[model samples]
Target: MQIIVFIKQTFDTEAKISLDASGKIDAKGIKYITNPYDEFAVEEALRIKERLGTGEVIVVSLGGDNVQEQLRQALAMGADEAILVASGEIKTLDEHIRAVILAAVAKKIGFDLIIGGNMAIDDGSAQVMTRVAERLDLPQVNQVTKLNLEKEKMECWREVDGNREILLTKLPCLVTTQKGINEPRYPSMKGIMQAKKKVIRKIKAAELELDLEQLNGDEVKSVWETIFLPAGRKQGKIIGGEFPATAFELVRILHEEAKVV
Candidate 1:
């Protein structure tokens, strides 16, 4: 079995964020960490390789050079090798363009299974992995809570709206992991030392043979017209005096002032 896990670096969930002068996230001096969901995917891939007793787990990420830090963490966690698709321009590309690059990478290196987080936290798009699978013409199951890889097939339990669906998929399938699938393990000291010796293969986006103009052009499906913070909340109103008067005032406010009724 050859397992490939896609990891992403995102802003720490608890980090304070502020908008820049242009109304976009400032991102300066912010701490970055592995996307939480991708950690689960990495753990699951490691478990699958261990269970099989013979396989290589490779972790791949697309970003600038800074992403190599997160890829090294994946290597420390047990992935045999790491690949960083390094491109400064990649940081500005939308989900569709990123997916195209990932699909191209997938085509370059075939795999029996591909795993990724159900969604990235920063954007919460949850679309890139599925889109990569679509471009590669592979079956994909998102929000997978349970996975079992047998001799030549995979059985998975996917979480949908208030329900679970069992899916049996053939080899060369992709699955995006959701939370509660398994607890991700921290890199051990020994593993950390070993990771220091692992070499990360770096590739530029231009090497992927994509048209630079099209990737940066209007072919992107979505456009961000503007970005801004929600307006500050207003102060609460008080209906004073006796209980009956307060209740009547509340009703009036709901019916007339707030217009919620």
Candidate 2:
């Protein structure tokens, strides 16, 4: 079996991201990490590969050359190879067209399964995986908490609203794994050493033979009109009183001010 994982490079939430004069968060000088949700996706692929005991795992990412680092990390965790799609122009969180383009590339390269994180934290838009599936015209399962495969069929268990649902899809399906799907294994010393020597080939958008003008002509990928950090609020001072009085005051605030009651 051959598996492809859709990974992304995102700003580490712990970095020094701040709003610039343009009112947009600047990525300058910020550290990058693999999309947190994609971790589970990668682990799921590796686990399935391990179960089969004979399969290839390929990690794919779309971004600038900086994303090569993320691919290397994936290799350190057990992926056999990595593919980097470097489009000098950036892709928006909403467009998620990049993932679709990646699915096409993966199809050209051939894969039995394609997986990604349910969403990215920086954008928190959980639409890429499904878009890829749609473009490929394959069955897809997102927000999956459990996955089981037997020969050519896959069973997926996902939590929706507050209930669980089961999804059955054929081989070569797409999926976005959730955090609890599996525990990600740490990169061992030997794996890390091997990762250092692994080749991470980069393919530019042009090399993919895609038309540059059509990149966002039909429908735009991502858009942000304005962004700003919320103003910090002052610490609250407790209003002490008798139990009933305090409860009445709280109720009054909820009804008159907060308007929740």
Candidate 3:
């Protein structure tokens, strides 16, 4: 089995977000980490390879050189190899462009299975993997919480509106992992040391034989018109008095002011 896992680097969930003068995220002093869901995808790929005892788990990512840190993290988690689709000089990469690059990489390398996070934490678009599946014309399952692999096919359980939908698909399919699939393992010290020696092959987007104009032009499906923080929440009100009086006042407030009644 040859499993290919797609991972992404995103800002740490706890990192404070602020916009610059130009209405873009201020990257300075912000920390980055592997997308939490992608960590699950990488761990699952490692587990599959370990169970099969005769397979390779390759981790692929697309971004600037800074993304190599996340790739190294995946490599430390036991992926056999790492590939970085360098987004050279392209400042704005929308989900469509990202899918184009990733699908192209996957096509070039070949795979028995492909896995990725249900959605990236930063954008939460959840469109890249699905688009890649469409481009590759392969069976795809998303929000998969459980998976069982066999010789010729895979059986998986996906979450659907609070229910689980069981699906069986042939090999060479793609899956986007959701939570509750498996707990990601932390990279061990030994693995960290070993990862230092692992090679991460970097391929520029131009080398993928894609039209540069199309990729930077119409391939971008969306653009960020503005970047700003959500409005701060209003302060809460407290009603203090006798129980019945407070209750009556609260009801009146809800009915007349808040209008939630």
Which candidate number would show the highest lDDT if scored against the true structure?
A: 3
TM-score of each: 0.91, 0.86, 0.92
> Model 3, 184-249: lDDT tens per residue?
999999999999998899888788888888877777888888777999998999999898999999
Of the pair 1 and 3, which is ahead by lDDT?
3
Sorted on TM-score, highest at the top, how do the candidates line up?
A: 3, 1, 2
Residue pairs clashing in model 2 are: 95-221
- What is the model-wide C-alpha lDDT for candidate 3? 0.92
Scored against the true structure, residue 59 in model 1 reaches a CA lDDT of 95
lDDT of each: 0.90, 0.85, 0.92
Clash pairs, model 1 backbone: none
Error of model 2, residue 79, in angstroms: 0.3
lDDT of each residue in 1-261, candidate 2, tens digit only? 999999988889888778878878787888899988998999999999989899999999987777888999999999999998876754452446676578668877898999899999987878778888888888888889999999999999999889999989999899899888998888999999999999998777676666656765654556787787778896774768898899999888889977998
CA RMSD of each candidate after superposition: 2.0, 3.1, 2.0
Model 2: how far residue 227 lies from native, Å: 1.7
